[model samples]
Target: MTASHILLVDDDVELTELLADYLTTEGLEISVANSAEQALALLAPPARFDLAVFDIMMPGMSGLELLQQVRPSNPIPVIMLTGKGGDIDRILGLEMGADDYLSKPCNPRELLARIRAVLRRMQTPPSAPDTRVIQHWGLALQLAKRTLLFRDTPLELTSAEFNVITQFMQNPGVVLSKAKLTERVLHRELTAYDRAIDVHVSRVRQKLSKVLPEQELIKTVRGEGYLFIGEE
Candidate 1:
């Protein structure tokens, strides 16, 4: 098995070094970047990083800025490291297409768990039999390719957004609670005040709306959850 490669971008050299050593020992290939500029250089074409861990508060190019710059072309899963209680940063990171996030000064073990979860979500099982493309309301989700096409026009979605829409489309009209969606999409139990799932769902809606103006594909059920309104 080829070890998953990770790019760790943070201005905290000591922390990056420590994390690199720890994650390396845990069967991951780690590349440390002390700044966002360095991270970009490493992320250039031909670079194959399975995932990225970015610190949100770095000087110069903040992690959010870096994410904005990279997300347009790069689909690599990103996990943002935010300051403790930085709910705003957390939401912003997700809105900017980060796959997951963690509060800073966190346990390395927890980061590892998040990394593994994101990587798992990104993987397609070789022996899996479900390769059929899911088409609903003119939108086609190619399961095997992990791509979406609306009216034969491709939609660029982040990994997290793709997973969210997959859940919605797979169970159309089902009011999937935040807890359920979090479990399925994020591979974790939802915590109180956690808005990660909401942001991802919102992003999916926004993208779909661009190609689906005048139609609301996903409906928010107040006091409940969200439901994908499939073909009637």
Candidate 2:
């Protein structure tokens, strides 16, 4: 099997080099970019990566900006590394379309786990049937393709966002707890004060609203979780 390629973007040259060496041993091809500008240059043409790891706090363009710029045209999964206490940055990163966020000084194992989780979501399981499809109201979801269509119009969604809506469409009107949503969509356990799940949900809502402006499709059940209104 070909090794997965990853772009590691961070201003910390020492940290990026160390992670590149470590991640390489774990069967991943690591491409190093010491700054977001360089990262963009590498991503310009002919260069492709399965996933990208970016440090939230960078020299010129922050990870958030990088995500914003890349997401508009690129669907590559991104895992952001934020400062140890950068809760705000983490949340912002998710809202900006990051596939996952890890606190800086993260354990290599945990980072690897997150990377694998994101990659898994990026791929359709081999066991998945080709004809799998779900249609709710005007929304159509192609499970195998991991694509969604609203009134036959394709919607641009990150893999994480797509997974979140998939969960909602699968169990429409059923309230889904943050913990359950986190596990199902992010493939990770919910942690205390973790708002990544919520941010992803909000992003989904924003996209959905842009497509269906008349009514609210995702409703928040205060103090509880969220539910999808199948016919809103």
In Å, residue 185's CA in model 1 sits off its true spot by 0.8
Measured against the true structure, the TM-scores of the candidates, in listed sequence, are 0.95, 0.94
- Per-residue alpha-carbon lDDT of model 1 for 39-118, expressed as tens digits? 99999999899999999999899999999999878989999999878999999989888999998897999999999999
What lDDT does each candidate get? Answer: 0.92, 0.89
Q: What TM-score number comes out for model 1?
A: 0.95
Lowest lDDT block of 10, candidate 1: 124-133
Q: Residue 140 of candidate 2: its Cα lDDT?
A: 94
Candidate 2's displacement at residue 59, Å, is 1.6
**All models, RMSD in angstroms:** 1.3, 1.6
Q: Write the per-residue lDDT of candidate 2 for residues 1-232, one digit (tens) a residue.
A: 8999999999998888888899999999999999999999999878889999999899789889988899768878999999889988888888877888998798888999999988887876778466667888689999877889988888988888999999999898899999999999999999888888999999999998887898798999988899998864
